[model samples]
Target: MLKIYRNTSIFIFLVIIGVQWGFYKNYTSEFPNFIGKTNIIHIHGALLMSWLVLLIVQPLLIKTGRTQLHRTIGKVSYVLGPLIIIFLFLIGKGSYWRAIGKVPEHDILRDMVLDSRGLISFAIFWALAMLYRKDAASHMRYMIATGILAIGPGVGRGLINSFGLGIGTALTVTDLIALAIVGFLLGYDIYKKKNYKPFLVVFIVFLIGAFLWQVRDSDTWQSFAKSYASMFY
Candidate 1:
């Protein structure tokens, strides 16, 4: 079981690297314009780069079984993890709002309250991860949650560039792709391993439900936005 976990961690780390590389290559072209538009863009970009580097290096530390070093860094990671997720959430909200040209029956602005399911799900998962800090299973679930949480934007950007689906279709399709990949991972694990990993199942189920709900629930999202406003104010 330890061996399987170690291997899975390594595999996920590499996959994150590939995802990062793709993200950089695909989106760096917009950095100049994006950065000029909002200071949030620059901060968000720097943090994401750091997060990606940490993701890649973290498994190396774990692979070497350097528990002390890993634990020290893990403490810092616990704080930064949610911050990164929040940054992504805000950025997504900003980007989607700016992109809506012709509002349909519903579009990014009308329904995008608090980044909807994607970001909210990430926050909850990361929160739970910290709550379960003593459990290895819980920690790993948070890592997977972070990976999938970041996946929506990564996959969305890739899809928009590669396929040129219009605005709503592009985002919706991209999110669906992210969701699909995560779903595939969980389903494959359960089918092949013949066990549903509880921690993973909880996070994934939360994500899927949030994703579907945010996309469809405009009024609820509006209420959610007001709630987010109240949090900081």
Candidate 2:
């Protein structure tokens, strides 16, 4: 059963990253519609897609004892990692406003940046993952956390766009699923490793909720976000 679950986890890890990266494998005869005009958006999308592809491939490479190659990619990952942070704020500022209907009452950009619990979660987990690189088990667990953290925006987008739901509620529900994902991983980590000290995970979730609360009542933030969103539209 343990082996089965591990295999299943790897398979899921592949699928989540695979379909996303595949979506932008390049405009071709078999698959097109890879159309976004903004350079920041396109570059960030391609970079992130590469990151996800690396996520899927890294484990296999390690398993086959290609540790040297893995380390070389690790160097690139260090650079791209921060770029992800930058783009998260940049693209997410736009995305959040876009999701919320460009309201006059709130600054979605501020909410996306200052109110960012998800991005912080990714930061913490990715940092820890890098820090624990010498310790494979700890590194793997943190990477899993990072993957879960990375997936929320995609999941949130899919939930609202694909399901015809209200964007606000859809995003909240999407965040909830990410919280659930962390909870499940925490439980699994405990079962597998006999350790339950997921303080980092708890910190991330609390920040997310608190950030949401902070944004809910800011007047200046609302105006700024609305105006920031307007620049593009």
Best model number under TM-score: 1
- Quote the positional error of residue 219 for candidate 2 in Å: 7.2
Candidate 1 lDDT over residue span 1-233, tens digit each: 45655665665665565456446654566665544457776778677666655655666677777768877887877668777787867787676656567564245435553355556676676676677777766566566666655555665556566667554565566466556666776686678773446445554665565465445545665565546544642
Residue 122 in candidate 1 has what lDDT? 65
| Every candidate's lDDT | 0.61, 0.60
- C-alpha RMSD in Å of predicted model 1 compared with the true structure: 4.4
For candidate 1, the 10 contiguous residues with the lowest summed lDDT are 105-114
lDDT by residue for model 2 over 102-131, one digit each (tens)? 554344454553335555666777787788
TM-score of each: 0.70, 0.70
List the pairs of residues colliding in candidate 1. Answer: none
Local error of candidate 1 at 13, Å? 4.7
Off by over 4 Å in 1: 1-27, 30-35, 92-114, 167-181, 184-233
